[model samples]
Target: MASYLAQEVQLARRHDEILSQRSVLLQQMETHLGDKKTEKTLQMLAADAAYKRNTALLNDIEAAEKRLQAGVHLQPHPNIVKIETLYWASVEESIPKWEQFLLGRAQTPVGFKKKKSSEYNISHAKVAAQR
Candidate 1:
């Protein structure tokens, strides 16, 4: 009976030790699982952000392409001739005056045809006053 009691005590102590070890293992597993879950969540968020950014960039590119296509399909200007006439008129008057002043002599001896009426000529004072 004495030997049996000693054996029972030893078994009880061993059972207690095993239970403590199991508790420690369970805590460690819980901590590891939590870390894994957090890591995966962060990875998923990063991927989602990247996907959204790429989608927006793609949308912008498509919009620009649409604008380019629309621009290409537009009709040509109807008053192209009138615009050219006006542009040349300004150039012919200004370019000769600029060249004459810079070279200290008139490059085109024939000169830019003067306006038919002096009233049409704009003086420096008149232009400055208008401004």
Candidate 2:
């Protein structure tokens, strides 16, 4: 929320600066086409790059404002609440450690030792190991 507000303020500052520059360019455009030595004035007046950049910035600002209005940052995530609730419920029910694995409360199992089965070692695999 605070981050978006800060960006909004920054964009407004840039908007004002661009408007000031646009005014200057427009004024130059008014007197420039007939003048042979005013290439810079013509270039400045004709370039739409700045306007396009500002248009993109305006889009971002509008999106941020919409998110702000929706109060997205203040809302609790439904998934997070559900996951925490499940965890706490499991704890409260005194679920057995082994059963907790079936309930999705378990951490990853420790590494396993290699077995007589040779599926992982192709060179050692035999006829019975073949699918």
Candidate 3:
């Protein structure tokens, strides 16, 4: 409850900060436009947009807080969960394909064979020494 209130306060402060910054920007825009009528129109539009965005965010937070306070446990839909699980599982299954696409080559499989140190010949040793 306290956390929600703190979050709400923080959000309000941020919204006000954004509006203050935008007000300065709008003043600069008004100077650039040089038409009182157009400047007023633009200012109104900007303010309306900002108000909508801020109100929407505040409403969402308020709703969430209210729901939390109500203490009503809600269960997720099984179908939705099942679908998401399958989707993620498919994504996990296709990771190798994604790696191949991104890398422009096949990914080395697990437990790939490697030459034993004993398999290195004198020529190989000489090449390594040259490097």
Candidate 4:
């Protein structure tokens, strides 16, 4: 988790650098405002995209921090001792279930109560039981 947080911090720094460059480009484009409206528009659009990308990175960092906090609260001093072939192979399949569990959806043994359906009033207990 410390490594993950460090990587995210590095990524945020990179995004900040890119955002700085975008700001500079926007400023240069502002100087040419009277000439070539199309070019100025394109530059603005590019800056906007960069801003959106940075915003997304901020959101990802926030989510990662939240997950880290939740994990620490739930499992202190967690360690990975070994990984068998079967468990390693099924990691891709299990990740989504674990994500759902983290997001408050019920899981086998760990979470017994099923979440209520948001779109429809119908109870999906039968469907969940099948899983």
Q: Which tens-of-lDDT digit does each residue in 25-114 have in candidate 1?
A: 999999999999999999999999999999999999999999999998996686986888899999887875687756876444455455
Model 4 lDDT tens row, 1-131: 99999999999999999999999999888877756787788899999999999999999999999999998877333244234545776876677768776778756535455555763344465567778
Residue-level lDDT tens digits of model 3 in 27-129: 9988877787787999999999999999999999999999997765766689988999999999899787567756878755555565667676765988999
> What's the distance in Å from true for residue 101, model 3?
69
For model 2, give the 10-residue run with minimal summed lDDT: 108-117
Mark the 10 consecutive residues where model 1 has the least summed lDDT: 106-115
lDDT of 4: 0.78
Residue 55 error, candidate 1, Å: 1.5
- Which residue segments of model 2 deviate by more than 4 Å? 1-38, 47-52, 55-71, 77-80, 91-131
Candidate 2 displacement at residue 87 in angstroms: 2.5
Descending-lDDT candidate ranking: 1, 3, 4, 2
Which regions of candidate 1 fall more than 4 Å away from where they truly are?
74-131
TM-score of each: 0.51, 0.29, 0.28, 0.32
Q: lDDT values of the candidates?
A: 0.86, 0.77, 0.86, 0.78
Per-residue CA lDDT of model 2 for 1-131, tens digit only, reads: 99999999999999999999999999897767657457767777667777888899999999999989889668579999999999999876654544656678876334434454455565455544774
The backbone clash count of each candidate, in order, is: 0, 0, 0, 0
Lowest lDDT 10-residue stretch of candidate 4: 75-84
Kindly report which residue stretches of model 3 are placed more than 4 angstroms away from their true locations once superposed: 1-34, 72-131
